[model samples]
Target: MKIIGNLFSKVLILIIVLFTLMPDASLVMAEETNLALKKEVFVSRETSGKEHQKTTDGLMDIKTSSKSWNAKSSDSITINLGAILDFNQIVVYEYSFQRANGYKLEISNDNISYTAVKEDSGIIASTERNFRTNAPHYVGVINIEKQSAQYIRLTVTEVLENKVSYIEEIEVYNSSDPDKFATEDTSLNASTDLVVDSAFGFKAPKVSKTIEENYAAGKPVFVSRETSGKYHERITDGIKNISTGGHAWNIKAGDYAIIDLGNAKEIDCVIVYEYSHLRAKDYVLELSNDMSSWTTVSRVTDYVSLNGETGEKSNAPHYYGKIEFDKTSARYVKLTINETAENKVAYFEEIEIYNKANKMPEFNAQPKEEEIKLSAPVVSESIPYSKEKFHIYLFIGQSNMNGRDNIPNSERVILKDVFLLNKEGKWEYAQPYPFGTKYSDYQGYNRYSSVDEGTKNGLNSASSFARAVTDNIPDDIGIGIISNARGGTSIEKWQKGSGEGLYEEAVRRTKEAISMGGTLKGILWLQGESCAKKEGYLDKLNQMVTDMRNDIGGIDDVPFIASEIIQSRPEGNVTIRKISEKIKASDYVSSVGTNTIDGLHYDAESQQLIGVRFAEKILNKIYGVTVTSDALLASLYNKEIQTEEIVPDYQFKIKINGKYLITDVEPIMHENRLFVPLRAIFEALNSTVEWEESTKKVTGIKGPKTVVMHIGSQNAYVNGVAVQIDVSPMLVNNRTLVPIRFISESLGAKVEWNQEIKTAYIELN
Candidate 1:
């Protein structure tokens, strides 16, 4: 009995220790439930081949994860956890690298309101990598802190063109568990008929009464020419992520895609997202009912012609094209790739077709070309408004300009005489909504009272900007906010011309707004988040500024405030601010957002602040106002960010054999050669310089020798002898810069460079 008692005592103590360290058995049983297993999941949009399948399979291993779910671009998936639960974390599971570019995880209970939990690129982290069991290596697992929700949503921001965004499985837990997912709630489980895909599976969402449908989604695609790859039908595969097995079809120059809608349907719009970086061809879209005769539906039709003269290198931004016209009936739509760019291919990813009557609720791209034309009448005879005193401000950019942050009723303001351009091409009283749709899409919808607008119906910087502009001025001096911005759109999408693209649309609207007897006070811009990491952003931005100034009158006369973006990515803000320095008439404002809710967008307060800044900057820069109506506003806006004065960036102090020489254009070093203004150094040596614009030749004449160099040529002629220069002569602010050492030495001056103090000494003895 004593021996038995000893063993029992030890076992009982062990049990006590286990119970103390581990969670209470009854508590775990009551709290730990896999809320998503067999629960009803809803997807925003479901295509044919890449459909939403049974993701609640209660498995996270690699093999079973093949039964994945899919969501289209800018589409979302929502899962109902049956009832509200105080869950602390969400553990989403997916395969490796087989995903889109970005996605957002959100938590909500009522289904109408949502809070973005995590909005990161769906890439796995080093700590989350688990090659043995799950894929994603761990992009799907998002943690929610001090939060409770019964419903969760995941939205795919940008997919690989037409590729479907996929995920293996999603599991919600009460704790941040690594592996142990407790048994699901039996009461919430239901018999599902959705088929489990053999490989990354998908089941189409059942047709709903109100779901915005994609007509050409998952339809049969027949290419005019196909390469060796198996992606011949990828156009209709509804796959937006990378097709690693094969690239999208861009094999041959004349390759085209023919999408069969399965039945004759009326369509007006066709949008295509191409994969290749080079595609500067005039694409033709034709529709047919009998496959014999075709009717041309225009747009991006004259690509090369629309964008001035070709030979300028094309890029990926030009490929995301859309064509909209009068509604037409057709069963087959064909897209032909133009064959202009040699060595560069036109790889296509996704194509969507839509009718005017069945336009997606969220599709407020650009109003029809005819609608933009209708603005003339409104400008002529619409309502009672002043043309001279009414100041027109064009607001253009990406979502930040379009408004992504929610605004409370307290923040909502509708000023008298302040107007917003409506879809009807008429100026209407500014609405209380924070977010602005395309000028043509605004139906005066107000969401401030409903409250908790989330990302939808939020306040835009333009509205706040307008209110700020109108507050101090006389009642007669009103402002019009022309909202023309699209979310997730690259700056390339706003390229000049491109056949009724956003750029041309903005130009037309600006002209129309001016026709309303309003002076072009200024243009407010906030973009660059899309291609912040893309190369040649400066060149593209300069081209946009040049093109806009060329198209709009007085655009160069006013302050083109290029605003910075959120702190999440500092590259865009850094790059965009350079425009103010590069362009004389332009200026920049600091980002008007802080404490970002999702690390991507601003909240209501930030948007209001943005408006205040725009008003302050425009008043300070354009109107040359030293004092604002409010003393605080003047102080806030007058805070200088970057000085416009010409300052030495490299801290260079030029010395001609020890005498400091001040230059109008700062001397910069390139290719190990210190470049100085051709006239600055040449004249310092008493040498006269002559420039030939036609030949791009810089000729410097000294007492004994003469040297010649082209604007962008490294090869030069010194005393009639050929010489290879290390750095080419370049033009800056209309002042030509040439290699100082090469030019000074060629002109009989000894040149010495100081590495310590960055002083260049030119000796002329």
Candidate 2:
């Protein structure tokens, strides 16, 4: 008995193991064969009787009933399955009413031989009378005995109405249980369109809205305003509770987003759900096979925004709306919101695209090349340049970096030692407007209108920066600039490998500049305003620097310096501070600026000053050459002010670099010291004067230094450092006056005051 029990337990264990390893029988039986792929078709004569026949006009369109093929009276079409296929069912679709009383199906193993079903056989009769009213189409499913045949013939016969027998499409099924894969009535004109293949004769319904639905479920999206993951974040999070408190993809006019559908699809309509209380007034729908290239499909100058409750709702009415355009096949759909009705932010809660499956073959039509007659070859003279003698720098960023301010007369003259790599990729005498025709490749990334024009007014800091560098460096070493910048661009545009990305173009131009021969010294960047509202700017900029250094070979440790945007509004203070701190703390960046004018861009005077500051940074960091503010002043102005002492009244005469600073106003005694007009000395030192009424502050700038003082204030700041003055700056005759000794000495200039001779001397450098 014990031996028998042990043997029985071993047998049970073996049985359990065998059962665990067995394949699923249900899954194996559920698989069905599809024989309607890669087949050939032949028709006796098409209804149109033309080369362009409607019989083969994408009868497999599957989604919409707008396209159809017609067969009038006794029209027979033959289909070669290429191999023997066992099919149990056949379905035929009609665009209009069913006029054909019967369809006779014949099967043949060889094209020359055929076998037809007898008339008495019940396979050819149908009276279900089911039709898709919204799609306006009729389908007839005919059940047939399972048979294997290589060629099948479908004939429209037994015409009942006026000898007009129209067949929109046809399909065949390989499953023994024909209902297993039948097109359900619920799928017609429903949320999803049923896609059927009529060519191979299979009822395979592909989901037409798959592309858009997949995007909402987590696909990549890019926007002009926000290039980071933020663009797709709000859309794909699946949180459609569009309460005013929740996050949304908010944009202003001229900002747009691109939804990548992953592959090409025949698209016609798009649905957009806007944020509460905000709707885009104008929008453009565009399509593209390649993400880099795009063609506009439709433009909606005025679109209605709606409000709804829950599940894609905003506070406003009709939060969701659909837009239809000319049918087009594209892999990418770009929706650009041009303007908003209330001038409110164009915020979107969700966006979905609807497209049909592309049944046609892909054929990219190329433009024909025009024939050209060759003329005599022209020889060009080569200009010689020493590669090692040139020190190159790249100027990159948005409008402020491209320089919107006018160039001052004192700084307009072209410096012989400085060269500009213009848009044409040739080096010329360095001047303002680094973004010219040569650097116009930046237009590919610029979404703004003013940013693309080559003839637009541009005055950038590159020329001034080059001039300052050349003034400080030795004559043998020439300075060159690769100027590539666009106005109203964000840091996202500067990312690498992005289609129509400025960063990719910048690196390409940088490499091109390097090929022309030169030691790339550094990069000059001055942009931040566009992305100030968002975070992660530091990471994006750092990655850009790394990519540039890696792409532009032989410049691994190139220095990148940026400028702190002038934050004129209180709201921008934190963002500006963060950007400034990041720039100052970065290892790739050597130095950043503290100068700005009007908060949006630097003034003309500050632009030159910033340029001098850039030179100072390069000189000190790269060449180990120390540059003082006084050096910038002396090199920039080259003017002199004379001073004389009057012994009788104990009055002192001051001279500004061997010339008189003021011929109209003499030195006035205040608190036992001679005071001079602030503008007189500052202008003589090549500085600019501007008064801010909002802050009651007087700001003066001269090449790398800035003196900011408030009216009736005893304290003043020089280059953001605080210092006390013996006599506060006073307003006399609507001009600010300051103590000569303190202002001159603080700017690294020599100041001398003689009590007996009443004479004062000031040397700039």
Candidate 3:
């Protein structure tokens, strides 16, 4: 429940105490003792979970695993030793992913002021290129003539080109002997090994050629002695798919981890997967039958960090080193690390012995799914039945408002008269996504929806709210959704006068929805993920609500509701719950349901439950209209289910000048010519249009230009001149669909067709 991070999200901490030192592990400190252990570590900026405490955890003195302090725009790390010590050496390490390739060490006496160490005046940075091909040089050690200081600061001045900064452990050693820790040559290939974690083979399977079974996995592992890091039992635990840090047995040079394969058997191939960042170069492998007599299998001595042997760590971190030889019959296999690829310590993720008996874990690789184009049902300007009220709501804020529910074509919620604002700013019958899913139609929605490589990236809170609200109201009444919710946006963006951002975009969409005929009954605010840990969110949110009321014309007494975010963000949840106190009518729904694709975003069932909760608050509190809840309806609908039917391949767009021609009826392609609704495009061209239902004819008039066309007729009259057209006029969804090219050309406007993006541009005269 404790979230240890910066006081303010993304804000840098200059001077603060973040940790309390634990009881002293060592009674007296010497050159062999790590003075930095159980001390306070202060970083400029650290991400959540990767706090500054990890830097002084004493896992590995110079090499780090997943236990690291990941920085955000970090500049330096200051370690407080609690008391002044005459230390001669300070060792700092970079991470497997974030490589602080260059750094400088500074000492502070007052803990407020600092000066560079006397041994080094310039920065300690490596000029090596293609660090992936060669092991990354990520160590910065300064052995100064014993200086008395309480605080030591390591400033990461330069980073590996295009790489981030992740600080691992920092070790300080005090010595009475002056020549204890001297400045050693650090520009060697076989000394320091650090690289990217996203490399291909870090957690992926890499078996030896013609080898399928692993005889050592899940077997008992016995190490000769304890090493630097932790977890010795992981040497035999399968390590192909999971790459967690602080795992595996960390052994000093010439130490061995013995994997007991239950009983002895014939073993031909031995593959060792060492920690990718700190790979072991030289290792002594032997086979033991009775723990006394042993046959030496292989002793690696000249391994050059696997630079040219495998793919670079930037692209593919070679997790395993394969050794295939003649079959050796032995009950036990001993892997003794003689030398490390980089530092003095080495760790193994997995060690597999092949004897053609036990098979590895089952791996089922699912290929990425292909997206099929789907066309939603054609929505009319207004519903067929009338005589009822039309309520509207603004679904605004962060990712929770914009969601993904794996609702199939059957569970996909659809009401009779509910509507969703499309990405082109038009209205479609209420469904999961109002904004078009395709990039060519509405690219912005696709940007957020297709972020994850999963199938459940559809559905929002608005559709379910509409269904619940409609059930409470009259049968003929309907709802139109003005959805402009952007995921991961802070409340600051929604505040009015924020300038040219989501604020302006939300106001524009609301105005468009309002202009189409509906009341802005309420505003649904579901943001604050970006600034979850920050303070002053309640005041900012109040300002945004007041501004939205003033700027988004009409309905001053409308209800404004905020939903409680996931329990993970407790601070943000507190702020959201406090909004009800600010606005008398507004309500805040409690966080509910599980089944999230990622633990962050709410899943479909949860999204549906949230929708119903919001609607319940609005209907009972805002409208003062409540009905006894049907437990079955709230949980699962037992009535006849309504399925969603989408007309396939029924979309094309018409752009006049530069702006999109937003219309209720979208343009369609027929007979190689684009057919758009006559009224919308004519009005865009400063032309007046008239339709005759009896004759099935339409006429467009702009200044002196006049064009006439009849439905299902191939001949058209423009300025009283008869012209033969390739495609006839048509009627679709009760709207007069006309050939756009013939109409634009007759009006003397230049029309250009772009096939790549599937749009027709018209330059009006």
Which candidate wins on TM-score?
A: 3
TM-scores vs. true structure, each candidate: 0.34, 0.32, 0.38
> CA RMSD for every model?
24.4, 35.9, 29.9
In model 2, the runs with Cα more than 4 Å from the true position are 1-385, 432-451, 569-599, 638-765
Off by over 4 Å in 3: 1-375, 385-388, 404-410, 433-457, 627-765
- By summed lDDT, the worst window of 10 consecutive residues in model 2 runs over 440-449
Q: Model 3 scores what on Cα lDDT?
A: 0.61
Q: Estimate, for each residue in 178-209, the C-alpha lDDT of model 2 and write its tens digit.
A: 66544534233333444555543333434542
The TM-score ranking, best first, is: 3, 1, 2
Across 397-501, the per-residue lDDT of candidate 3 in tens digits comes to: 777776643343434445567776665566666654333442122122222221222222355666567777877777666787776766556767667776637
lDDT of 1 at 39: 75
Give the clash count for model 3. Answer: 5
2, model 1: CA deviation in Å? 52
Native-to-model Cα distance after best TM-score fit, residue 279 in candidate 1, in Å: 37
- Comparing 2 with 3 on lDDT, the higher-scoring candidate is 3
Q: State the weakest 10-residue window (summed lDDT) of model 3.
A: 126-135
| TM-score of model 2 vs. true structure | 0.32
